[model samples]
Target: MLDKVHDLFRLRTSPVIFFVSAGLIAVFVILTLVMPEGMASFWGAGSGWIYDNLGWFYISGLTIFLIFLIIVGFGRFGRIRLGQDDEKPEHSDMSWFGMLFAAGIGTILMFWAVAEPANHFAEPPRGESTGVEARSMEAASEAMGFTLYHFGLHTWTIFALPGLAFAYFIYKRNLPPRVSSIFQPILGDRIHGPIGKSIDIFAIVGTIFGVAVSIGLGTLQIHAGLAQLFGVSDADWNFIIIIAVVTIVATISAVLGVNKGIRRLSNFNIWTAIALLIFVLATGPTVYMLRGTIEWAGVYLSMLPELAFWNDTLADTGWQNGWTIFYWAWTVAWAPFVGIFIARISRGRTIRQFVAGVLGLPTLFTIIWFGIWGSGVFDIEFNGDGGLVDSVLEDGVETALFAFLAEFPLAPVTSAVAIMLVGVFFITSMDSCSLVLDDMCNGYEGKAPLHQRAFWTVAIGTIAALLLTATGEGGLAALQEVALVFGLPFFILGYFIMYNLSRAMREDAGEVGFLRTRRWLQTLPPEEYERRMEEADASLAEAVVAPDYAEGTQPENAPELEHAEQPPVVEEYRVRTGETPIIDPANPGDTGIPPRG
Candidate 1:
């Protein structure tokens, strides 16, 4: 027991990633502590410069990634599996979707489902119907379309690129599961040196800050829920307590391992969110939402290209920075961490299956969710006497959902459930992010030490709390700006990932074709084919029953057995013919050993 305890706390950590990520966080905290005013000014100016100058880069990079993912998903490479051809997936489809939703977008969906749509409706994007009033039916439809645009296929593609690359390398190539491993084709063994470590460290930094943004948002929303439900004091100490409680819950979940804690919690979160969505759909304008969902989906499809590339350079509304650019940066920032979780759950699935499941299903959920909330809020504001638009205008976006719920029966009960759902989403995200961070730091040498995971959980919670507390008045925005700054490098990295994955997939396809052709040759009709089949059967029987059987050795009943039933043999003719053995097309050097006989 004592030895086990020692092992738990032992230094089985990745030296460079661990220290480098830790040092980055330490420096930020120290800056915040020692020179709070100067740090704020520097971060504010730097983040502003980045947003103002590089918005186009973020837009173009994400657009390219989305297009690449679509091409690859429908192309020949889509049929390839992440693992060996014969291996099966580790989790059920439902469980897989649940976990991905929880880790990748659950909290964001919870936080933004109502607020985003309402905000867009309240202030329609520039150059809409000239006379349409804010929150009008036309404004609501445009708002839902915009929401779908932000949370739709493009966002998932950013995640799918990293997840698919890692899955191919880790499962197909038998490589370590690191962001650097995706660069193996480009850098070769140099991936194991400083270049690789630097890549992983950068990913770690992005994940930490990205997840910190989520945590900060979760805590703020939870405080709002508590203040609304139980009338709790909206004090700074109380906010700190909320972060502490959620962090403790998350740490416990992380320690419980993936299957037991994370999976179960993710399932709970999805079911609860579904129930809430259903309640709104059933109780509100069901027909408008149902019909509106289809209409908005169409609008989203038609307007996708325009919305995807729009930088508002000519309009100068600064709307792109606050909404579109911010959402893109947030998605890119969180992709590495969420992609790790996606790859972890996606063993034994084909590239097409992975892409469809990761990109299609979640985006469907986003559309439905925004459809229900957006349409429902519009119904109340424009058609009914509810003052939701007034509440949003008076208070803030965070209060949109609560204010909408206030018009319903059992407001407190529904609000409480919403809070619980957010809390569980927070927990699942925290645990998954910590697991990903542990893998980034320690590679695939089994799970990182318990203490190492615990350290990350603590660090995440600490940084989130400090960022929130230091800014005080508008801390969430401050944290988001910092997170977006870290996401900048990932835009550049996304291009390399697409190239490397494509290269690997082509290699896999060639090997698969070779084996297929060899099998076809064995099926050709002729006396020669019969002779070859008999020889293959003999070779396989001999190899299996007596591996060291001499070439000419035969049983005394060989002639009689020739007339008996003969099981067709599927010999690996390529290896015997001295041709290169079949390989995972994505991994040429990984020519797996051929079976004897």
Candidate 2:
């Protein structure tokens, strides 16, 4: 029994990464506990420094990521599959999009879909400079437009860029699914060195804090919903209990693995969210929302370029810092967690497919989501009582959604659904994040031991609960700022990832040439052609891993190659390409091609 207990907790991870990440997180929690006021002030000062100095850097970096992904997705690299040539996507399209939507911004959309737009409608950014009167038709239009901007393509691009790099390296290049592995093209063998470990450490810590902020936000939102529905006291103990219960559910889901737990919950979240959205649209002013959605989409697209690059430089209103800059930083902080999770489920997809699904689909859903909720709130403010805005301003953003729902029919039912949706979203995000954290810690070898995932889930929940109990909303906001500060490094790292991915893809393109018709090859016997295609895919996979083999190394946690049935394909590939394929005897694989001299 003791041995089994030990086995459950045993980890296949670098001591440096595991201990350092835990140590940093422990110190953060301790500091927050010991000197909550000082830590909050420190985080405030750090946030101010970043906002003053690096606000434009964040905006420009996100814009570059969007442009780079667009170019790569639509350009020649779009044709490159993330995995072997013949590999097909593991999850179906519905499940894939479901997971993406659930993990990307489900909880946030719930929390802010109505609150943000209403706030903006009350006081538009740059209203003084633009001469847009607050709460005017113009302000209403700009409000939804900005909501779409914050939740749209540029935001998704943060996740997409890292997801693309991770997918390419992990699925195609057979590198371990670590942030540092994407840098392998540039770093080579040094990816296993201190620099690589340092990158992973940052990823782990960033992921934790980022997810903790979300957990904190979700808990607060849940508490607000409970208070509204049941008259529950807004006590810290209640918040702790909420975190504890949700963490337990998330831990179980994490242990169940992606297919069984995460995927199902994600599908449920999407469907439930859709039902709730339809409830609003159908029961409320359906025509207005439908028509407004089209108009808002156009408005969003028209304003995207301006909004994407706007840094409040000309006006100097400090508005962008609180809104646009904060959103960008928050998304950057979330990139590692969301990116890796997206990458894990995105194997066997083309770059174009990944980008289109990650950026396009989510953005479309977001536009509709905000369109329904934003337009609903704006309609009430415009035509009905203007109390929705007052509710958001006075009652806090957490209660805004429920308060909005209360103005409609079946307020109780819709509010309950909304709360349920938030809870499920909370669970899905936590489970997915915990899984990603486990992967990073174990170097992405395979499914991590269940205890390790449970540990992360507990740690995240405890941190969130402690932050909530200790410093309440102020501390949560300060911690979120610190998460953004951590994101600055990732923003810098994004450029290097883009460079490395492009260089690696360019090299591969040079070797393999571009996608072309194989009419002559197809004229052969069907079985023969199939065999040839399989051999080609095997050869491509080998080519990707050949460099590591040449250097007598393998990525940490990479699976050993098995040679039981792949020799003929390698020989066939060698004969056709007129290139020698070296085979490593120690790690023999029928499909494994070794380093070419």
Candidate 3:
């Protein structure tokens, strides 16, 4: 007990950051519990004001990230490796992808997949409400399009830029892999100073809230699943108990280290998610699901540009505020956790491969996932007598998935599977979030102390439970407000990541950097460029030895002399093009020994 206490109190991290983050978290928890209504009102109004005023900024930030990431992936910067020239990926492609999906936004998708699309379907954005009723096919199609927009490439692009920047710097430049390190090119060694500490502190705050959001959602869903499956009560205490159990399990997993605990859980989560998806696709409206998936992909593609730029300012519809803006804020808040964790596991990949995997593969999974659940549920609720939408409208979003599952054959089994998937995703996300927060809290030096990880695991669950209890039914909204408020600075900080990444790429000594215009080319005329190239080539070639002249084959120009009377045969000197002869500046007449002829 004494040793454990000592370990917990050890100052392995920056003191300022550690205390400040802890203090802030404590303050928020206390205030939320003591003044629940006031806390909710403040967070809601504050974040809502930002969303209403700066919706354009959020839209533009996401758009810029997507555009910048695409440019990096396909342009001259594509071929640059994240590590040294010969290094390969730490994890295999399969392992990497599984982990990425598990750690990135797995739990978020679980909560939002069925709920978000259905909510959007009931209240379609940018459409005449009188013309399209809830559960209509038009509402379904429009919902899928917008839902895809919410969880699609824009989010991953935000993740990829920072991942690439940090990976390149950590592996190539040997800098610490922290959020603050992304500014090293602009800030220099001061990255270890006060400014850097402030950046990391911000990241820690964001990560804690970001993780709390997942914990809260997972708790709510798990409680709902229990009620749906076993006829358990959905009391707030039951939810608190669920959060406590998950937090304890997550702490154990985090203690087991990344390879053993986190990686295995991630792999399991992916396969479980896949099984759930397949079961839904096979057992539900298989034909409609397939057809709708095809159509939804096309719709998302066609509507992407307009949707990407839409702020709904003219019509004053609050849909963007509730959905798009909230999602952007959530993703931005979680960017550090996702980005840093990806960088940690992605040592051997090229910039292009990382960008593609981060932006494309997971996105493909997201689209197919929304297709299977969103389209499948829509078919039942609209055409069949399923009442899934009614359940959402009446009960809440947390009950949507379980209610949808209850309609199928073997309803109990499917509901149980959904619960298991959420539980696994919850554990995996917590462990991974702990890893990233640990890395940041410890100055990106090494693995955090075990006790520190445990503290954070507890802190995450505690804060989540406090907020949930404090706000009653408004817990998730309060968490979303927290995400939105913290996300504002990071949205701006993301641009700095892009600029610094490009600058760092330009300075790399590898293939990517080689493609940039040489300084001599930029500063010198064509004649000077040719001259410099010739000089460089000549300097490199000068290491080769000249042909030997044996005693009998001495140069014919050598003076003939008797053996005993011969003046020492003088070595001939010549201007060598291929060899670099060392010249002593102070004693230019002196020559070092050369190779024997």
Candidate 4:
């Protein structure tokens, strides 16, 4: 009976769904373009408000800092050595780390590798835009610097922190593989049940919402590139088209299983992506690219604090809110699926090595990609008469990228290869999502049954296309809100994992007995060890509770809030009899009670 119910509820996710998705898009596009003022204006404004107003950035940054402490706490003090004997999970041939890590971050990286640099170059940042306009080297470097900040160390670091926390909890602590699982060690066993499942549902749902934006934005850009570059005309719903092809391929790959299909796909995508970056770096502009690299690096290093944790609510939040906060939330929405994906992959690795590799290595690649792609754009701006930047502005982001390369040295070949690069990225992301959404729906441990992953992948893409057509840019706007809601709690969970893990490790690493000889650890009274552990527990709590923000102290106003001190929202009201009741402004739905009505 239960199986029958599950089958009924499960989405059919067929070609008909795609056809329905397309019809919806057509209707939505007509309405959106016709009523541009209403749909576009409000969504853009609300997005801006939520973008700048929300306080999640501070919360995410704080968790990142706690992760920093955890890194130090684990290595500087060493650990109890949970002998690396835990069995690794049965997964696809693809290195768990490679497939999951690259897929979640790779597609965006591909798009940004060239597109973002160009996007920022055309309208270099005002904060960094100084001196003469077009001819200035400083202006170009400023553009590259901003993109790197968005994609580089800090942004990806946000992704990795949650991954590390989640991995440690699941693999080391033996908890279920859920976002809330990180808190179970601290919150206790109940987190594995209904309460935890609710949290997982929210995280999973929020993640898919975020991924919907990824599919829509990414699909639109890639499809538009195909249309503009090769003149693939008559493709109204190019994203849905791309989704169909990629989902089919990934589904087949998923069926052969992870090791054969997913890993191969991830590897191919990674290498092709690298080749694409190399093509840009080698063929584009060398001198400007190299020079921009130095300047952006210096600027990013100097302004790291400001860029990573700016929370001046009243200041003109141009980049901070629109770009910085938005990306943080975006990554956070991704935290549940992607973070778990990363943690699942990393095993047999040390605490320090895991943290640094996950946090630092990819960042290095992000910086370079930003340099290569962004520098290419800057070169065109300062050197090659404003052709590329101009084209990008005139022809939209997708066409602009296609047009820029067509004018380059290897025009025909590069454009064709560019298509390949786009395909790998888009498809790789599709397959990865298929795997992720599948597992998320089922238990988040093993590779989801192939048929299931394929079904949801198709469903996710279809929904995104429909929403994109109907809501247009609002779809992207709503996708961001998904992150804002989930990023903070997950960030907090990351910190708890760190704190609890620290305590667990302290006992494990012989810290409690480090002072004692081995003989003492064994011979010492159990009562003495219990008393010491209790003392450690009290100390741990105090150490972990970050102070409230004040002008003088941190946590107080730091972008990375060490701790949050928000008072509970209270609902005050009076219930009345059948008499008409006045709703209080402070508490709506409140019924005013009359003395003896």
TM-score of each: 0.83, 0.86, 0.82, 0.72
- For candidate 1, lDDT tens digit of each residue in 1-597? 433443455755556567778899788766666666666566677678877898898888788888888788777778777776667899998889999888888888888877887788889876343465676777877788788988888888888888988887767655566788788667654555688889888898878878988898788888888888889887778878988988888888887778988999998889889999999888888898898788888999988988778777776878778778888887788788888789988998888899889999999988888888877887787778967777776887677778888877788999999989988999899988888888777665253557677777788898888877866644445556667777878877888888898875554344434111000011111222233333433222212100011223232322211111112332322223222224333443332334345
Candidate 2 ranges with C-alpha deviation above 4 Å: 1-8, 511-597
- Which 10 successive residues of model 4 have the least lDDT summed? 516-525
In the range 115-203, model 3's lDDT, one tens digit per residue, is 88888887878676436665677778788888898888987877887788878766655566578878877766556668977898888
TM match of model 3 to true structure: 0.82
Q: In lDDT terms, how accurate is model 3? A: 0.74
User: Candidate 4 regions off by >4 Å?
Assistant: 1-4, 7-49, 59-70, 77-101, 128-135, 311-317, 474-509, 512-597
Residue 254 alpha-carbon offset, candidate 4, angstroms? 3.2
lDDT of 2 by residue, 83-148 (tens): 766679999999999999777898999999889999999989879999999989999999988889
Worst 10 residues of 2 by lDDT: 517-526
Candidate 2 local Cα displacement, residue 332, angstroms: 0.6
lDDT (10s digit) by residue, model 4, range 1-597: 443444565532222222333344345345555664565555456556666556554535654664574555366543322123333344433454456545567767756666666766556555433442433565565666677777766666666666666655555544445665555435454453456556666666666666666777766666766776567664446556776676567567656655677677777766666786677777767666677676677777776666555554444536566566667666766666776666655655555656666656676767776776676776666666767776676766656556767657877677777666666655666566556555444433452344556665666666566656655566555444544555556655555656765554443233243221010001111122222233332211111111122222221221332222211110112221222123343443233322222
Each prediction's whole-model lDDT (CA): 0.73, 0.79, 0.74, 0.55
